[model samples]
Target: MTYCVGMVLEKGLVLMSDTRTNSGVDNISVFRKMFTWQVPGERIITLMTAGNLATTQAVISQLEERTKEPDERDNILLKSPTMFQVATEIGRLMRGIISERQDANGVKGRGRFTASIIVAGQIKGMEPRLFMVYPEGNFIEASLDTPFFQIGETKYGRPIILRGYDRQMSLEDAAKLLMVSFDSTLKANLSVGLPLDLQVIERDTYEAGHQHRIGHDDSYFAAISDGWGDALKNAFHSLPDYSFYRPDD
Candidate 1:
């Protein structure tokens, strides 16, 4: 399991994903789940995946292979005229791969090889867009009512995002918010581990504005983790005390 989040803000998009993939307690390993493709000044696309490692890796490998062969018309990441089309192409690819694997394995492969993806980026003339593609090949774009998406080990980090997200927030602030959320998830779940991948795309830049990997020794992340825990404790203590005794009743 892993945790990946993509947020849409006025300044641009912020994405982060954990690197842990575990089959069992002793079989744990790290694999990056975030992949990005950019056409310099033309467009930029980022995909963060979660679910079956094999399935996600297969999809990413195919995309990269296609990109390398310019003659391949299926290199939709670079050929798509619009961001929506790019997402549609990805959805189709994801669905095809999942279905093919499932059909080949019959009963044993049902949900075992399923995966989901969060695709975010900007196309030359369009506004930055974000989409969460489901395992079935369908997807929904982020809007005012839903400006972000989370997949895998989501329960632990979701509340923090819900309480703090703002559409107009700066990319820097967005990254900080994600760190706190990831930290909370890290503390509560063993499946999602360290060495997180982060990327920021400023609106209209058509390229990644910032990118970094947060390992266990990263001081900023360490501080965020520690500070958030203390802040939560202080906030809890500041709340008014509740009593079981009801004298008025």
Candidate 2:
């Protein structure tokens, strides 16, 4: 399992995904779950995936292969005229791969090889958009009512985002909020570990804005992790004391 989030802010978009996958206690390992495709000044796309490792990897590989051999087939990521079309194309590809493999592997493998992905990016002249593609190939776009999407090991980190998210906040604040969500997840779950991969894309700029990997020794992440814990403890202590007995007693 893993934890990944893609948030759409008024200023831009922020995406983060941890790099861990586990089969069992002794078989735990790390694998990057974020992938990006960009065309410098024309377009920028980020895809974060979670679920069966093999299926996700296969979809990513096929997408990458499209970029390299554009003449042979429709390089939808490069040629899609709108962000919606891009999401549609990605959804189609995801479904195709999942279904194809399921047929070959048989009915018993139905849910075993399933995968889901979060697609975030913008085409030139388009607003930055975010979508969460389901394992079945259908998807839903992010909106003001729900401006972010998370997949895999989500319960631990979701509450933080719900209480803190603001569509008007700057990209920096959005990233910081996600870091806290990630820290909360890391503390509670072993299936999701880091170094985490993060990327930001500013509105109207058809280029990758900021990118980084947060490893164990990353100082800023270390501070965020420690600071959050201290803050929580202080908040708990600051709460008014409650008593079961009457104050006079």
**Which numbered prediction scores highest in lDDT against the true structure?**
1
Roughly what TM-score does model 2 have, to 2 decimal places? 0.92
lDDT of 2 by residue, 1-249 (tens): 899999999999999999999998779888989888789888998889999898898888776564466667655577778878877877788888888888887844447788999999988877899999887878999998999999999999999899999999999999999999999999999889999999999998989999999999999999999999899999888998888897698
Per-model TM-score, in order, reads 0.94, 0.92
Q: Write the per-residue lDDT of candidate 1 for residues 1-249, one digit (tens) a residue.
A: 899999999999999999999998789998989988898898999999999988888888776564466665355687888888877877888888899888888835347788999999999999999999988889999998999999999998999899999998889999999999999899999989999999999999999889999999999999898788789999999998888887876
Model 2 segments more than 4 A misplaced: 66-74, 108-110, 246-249
Worst 10 residues of 1 by lDDT: 66-75
Model 1: lDDT of residue 110? 45
CA shift at 116, candidate 1, in angstroms? Answer: 0.2
